[model samples]
Each structure stands twice: as C-alpha cells, then as structure tokens.
Target: MALVKEGDTITIDAHARSLHLHISDEKLAHRRANCQPLPPRYIRGVLVKYTKLVSSSSLSALTDFNLF
Candidate 1:
C-alpha cells in the first residue's frame, strides 16, 4: 500500500478506498487530553493494540522497537 498523506489519517489507494484511516497514538493522546469523548480506558487499550499489531507486522522499519 502506498502512503499518500501523513497526518491523523493516512490515505492508501484512495482511488478505491476513501474512508481508510488509521489513527496514530499521538492523535489519540491529543483526543484524550482534549476530552473528545473517547474514554481514557479505551485509549490505553488502543495504544496496547496498536503496539501489538505494529510489532507483529512488516512495518518494523518504521520503528526502532526490538519486537520479534
């Protein structure tokens, strides 16, 4: 998938998928700080889930994690 944009949402293959968006941890933290309705507990869960998913994916180059 080719990344077309960099922000709260990354557009990949926009020609076929327009609603494809991935919320980053920084964005989630901002939402939690501003009290954007997403619960704090859920925010923690999302962080954990994101970490697990990324660590297991081929996107390891994007991060310096030693995740195996």
Candidate 2:
C-alpha cells in the first residue's frame, strides 16, 4: 500500500498491542519530532494499514500541516 493520507485511520503495533492513530498531519509529528531522540520509520510488516481519502469539501477551515 501507499503512504497514509489525512483522515486515514491507522492501527499500528505498539509493542504488545495495536494502537490506533489518525494520520492527519502531513509528515506525522511523532515521526518527525526533532526533540525526540529517535524518529519513526517505515517498518516492514509493522506499519500495516491502508489510506482513506478525506473529504475536503465538507471542511471549510481545516488548516494545512507545516511539512517543512
């Protein structure tokens, strides 16, 4: 599958159980936080989920994520 997009509900494995997270951020904050010692990466068989297209037509004031 391709990379996750906004409004896509993802269930990722967090140690013992699967943790559900919504990927609305453009670059995924937890994965891109510079203050954190380690950054998140795409792990084979670990990041298992599909992307769901978000309906932007309904949202009138949704702020875009800063990817830079």
Candidate 3:
C-alpha cells in the first residue's frame, strides 16, 4: 500500500464505512481517530490493469517526479 500512499494507519474496509472512499491518510487529518477496518476485496482488482502503468510510471516518475 505504501507504493500508492503512506502510513499503515489508514484502511480500505468498505464494510466499515458508509462510503467507499479510496482516499489517503490525509483524509483523517482532522479526525480524532481512524478505526476503519481493512477489507481485502475493496478496490482489489481495480489496480490489476493499472499495474503496468503504475510500475513503469512510478519508475519513470522516480527520475522525473513530474510524471506522477
């Protein structure tokens, strides 16, 4: 998960929240605590097709952050 974002404090459990927010930890910046559970299926396959894009883009982005 660190590849797309940071902090293990965040979660992707759609069953725990009202809306499925595919968001980052910054969304919790104003919150008191983040107790959201981690759902294994939530947004699971969404990245399958983007895998190659993510890998190559990330590698290219490392040398040129502008690509991100």
Best by TM-score: 1
Query: Tens digit of lDDT per residue, candidate 3, span 3-67?
Result: 33343344466787543335555654534254455554435465654542354653652433466
The positional error of residue 9 in candidate 2, measured at the CA in angstroms, is: 0.8
TM-score, one value per model: 0.22, 0.20, 0.16
Q: Which lDDT value does model 1 have at 5?
A: 39
Pick the lDDT winner. 1
lDDT of 2 by residue, 1-68 (tens): 13444667888786867666666564566456544443445434434221122224565323443422
Inter-residue clash pairs, candidate 2:
none
Model 1 C-alpha lDDT per residue in residues 1-68, reported as the tens digit of each score: 23223444555686786555486767556655666343455446777666544544565434545544
lDDT of each: 0.54, 0.49, 0.45
Better of 2 and 3 by lDDT: 2
Q: Which run of 10 residues does model 1 get worst, by summed lDDT?
A: 1-10
Against the true structure, candidate 3 reaches a TM-score of 0.16
Question: For each candidate, how many residue pairs have backbone atoms clashing (under 3 Å)?
Answer: 0, 0, 0
lDDT of 2: 0.49
